[model samples]
Target: MASSLTKGSAATGEKTFLGHPSGLAFLFMTEMWERYSFYGMRALLVLYLAANVADGGLGMNDATAVAIYSVYNAMVYLLALPGGWLGDRVWGARKAVAVAGVVIMAGHFLLAVPSTASFFVGLALIAAGSGVLKANISTMVGQLYRDKNDPRRDGGFTIFYMGINLGAFAAPLTIGWVGQELDWHIGFAMAGAGMALGLLFYFIGFRHLNPVSSRVPDPLSAAEKSAVVRKGLVWLCVAAAAYALIGLAGVFTINYALWPLTVLGLVLPAWSLLRIKRDRDLEPVEQSRMSAYVWFFIAAAIFWAIYDQTGSTLSLFAKGHTESMLFGFGFPESWFQSLNPLFVMALAPLFAWLWVALAHRSKEPSTVAKFSFALVMVGLSFGIMMIAQGAAAGGKVTPMWLVSVYFIQTVGELCLSPVGLSMTTKLAPKKYGSQMMGVFFLAVTAGDSTIALLQLCGVPTDTQSWFASQGALAALAGIAVYLYRKKVKLLMRGIH
Candidate 1:
């Protein structure tokens, strides 16, 4: 009966697009352009920082550039928790997304200014604004369905996912070209322009969105709102005090501050888990499922730590170690960033079909097993890179070497990327459902910070040793998870 109601709700005389709510079309387009601005700026950041001072770049060494990128990248995901909180309790998702887009556009324009101080400020703004947009938009997509059981939910999200990649794919080719061939600031301005265009598009089509877009998911009472504000103020004071102490200790540099901030960011997830574990209302099955999720979280973090190098370490390899001439014409190495998304568009459907075919034969792998496979495959990609490193010792290796690496990693991504959050939804307790996805994104934060931490510790990612070691560790983790897959499956019970 509930399913019938869900079906009926979907059939309301409301406007539809491709059998899904009309909201998806605008949401998809907005997200695509949002990603356009994001990936556009990101593709330039490290290169700009690492380029010679004479070339209008920041002139930082490779290590500093990579560490800075890691911090900014990590924070983008880390702050999503509070972003989600504001969406759930204060502003509605619609307002949150709109306001965040404005902030993001401002950030890109700020980055276009050629001052060091403004650049850092711009990064901070983008990271915070991205958090708000990132955490709430997908939840808004779910809201469009009006019911959890709507069969269109997965298909709708899949299309939305393609939007993300579409933006990522287009940004590098366009923005990368302008940034490399012309003034870098102009490219940044172009990114801001893309976002402006996106926002205009979303506003023009705003009426198509589901009504729930303007309703906060879990609004607090007046007293509760006051309490939340007080709590936020207290946390702010604590953070300020901590910063003062670090300054007094004579270690107040950007590098030192970032590590502490990352540590604090990581603590949120641990606290979230501990809070969940203490929920006495949960049944034994829910507790068991949470335990299984912990392992999944750990494995997913490892995968992201390796996969996200496309913007940092792998990017460096592309610019310096890989030959860039194609048909004797020079091109920007940032164009390589487009490959992962291109592969996603090409292979996602193939993999989608492969999974269904396997399921028909009763041979589909459990989520846990698939996670294991992803870890191993991503690890193997790096292991292949170690071989590429050997080849580079003679001269610049072919771009195909990196292409081959990306192809392998994209395959690995297909194995785990779509599965992680979907499993989070299935496994969450009702009480924590709204916050679980936010917590799940913390895996990305943790993974990016891990790279920064390694860099700070003098473990350069460009080294053959770093590649071999991390690769082997990831593979071993995969093997251990595979060996114990049955045990984790038992905890999940009927979840898979």
Candidate 2:
């Protein structure tokens, strides 16, 4: 690890913001604006796709729109592995992040062009840009902290996370409303402008950033670098050829655009596990820890499958079955998308305090137990929606029900997300650190790819029954993990 603090700087004891480095402020603002662009565009995607052609949308059906949404989101996570690698091996974090901002802005501009071709192209560009940007920015934040064991690390991260929620909370209310009330292209243009502002902020505060942000932690030897470049070019050519062949076969449709991502999502985790299991260099304890991590990955995938409906199935419910009117003024359904992040901003501090209080009492839940709790909470959130479905007045329920669902789900998120990241860092063998983080994200990719596949297969679309089924599965998974928590904890070799 590289520390950029001056000899007498905060790493040596001088206090900055909340006793941390000043660079955190710049990172926080940059991420806040990046997320503003990201969530702003995401909030409008499905709605824009499924709207009537006369209403400035592509006139896609719900299933098709949901399929696209799942694939695109999956790709965002799925590509992070390579994105992180590129940052480590080719471009350092600072330059990679800068290029990502430019690419993302270009994507939004492409969306502003009103055509089906442009829409898909824009989604592709945005997904690729986000893949490059998302993981690197978080890595840079870690680089800002000089001490690995810094007590303030958690608090600083909590503040950074709040910046994420702030952007997410504001995006839907702003860009979402503009897209719904004005023009879809206008909303996309706004997202582009948000990225521009983020880039501007980053450049203005560039001087505060540490030299660590521009360091390549793991540089390749000349021979290895040459081989890697050659392999990359080969794979690029192969992928292009495969796509061309698929299109020529007349089977390439928008609905199947996710197939490539889906295949990779399914295959990558299995490959990672196989590599881990076969690594003779790993000690027995390390192997056991990796085995336990596999279970956590499964549990996370299940949780995400149910939790991610907020962008797909739940969004559809908000459009068709949730009352959007408040005090006689109707609002865009996308405004409801803000509820999750809004609740996060409100509730995260309380959850943080709760965890600390529990820790002080020697009653903090085991990592596996926390994962189980998250699963159950998310399951129960869906159960609430199922019950709300039963109480619908004339087939439409008040938006408070959705609000309640998001609130509970946010609690689940706070429990799982931070813990998952911490666990990955703590349990991964040093040699496999980056690959282990990639595996963690693969869980998200698996969940999203599964959802996309389900949509493509024309799964039964009854909202109530669907929610009920997902809740039941999630609850059962939680119970199973809870039952085996003690066994799993042993495999963790003292890690919490």
Best by lDDT: 1
Model 2: colliding residue pairs: none
Local distance difference test values of all predictions, in order: 0.86, 0.85
User: What 10-residue stretch in candidate 1 is worst by lDDT?
Assistant: 1-10
Q: Any runs in candidate 1 off by more than 4 Å, and if so which? A: 1-14, 234-252, 327-329
Clashes of each: 0, 0
All candidates: TM-score: 0.93, 0.94
lDDT against true structure, model 2: 0.85
Model 2, position 128: C-alpha lDDT score: 89
Q: For model 1, which pairs clash?
A: none
Number of residue pairs clashing in candidate 2, backbone atoms closer than 3 angstroms, sequence gap of 3 or more or interchain: 0
Report the poorest 10 consecutive residues by lDDT, candidate 2. 1-10
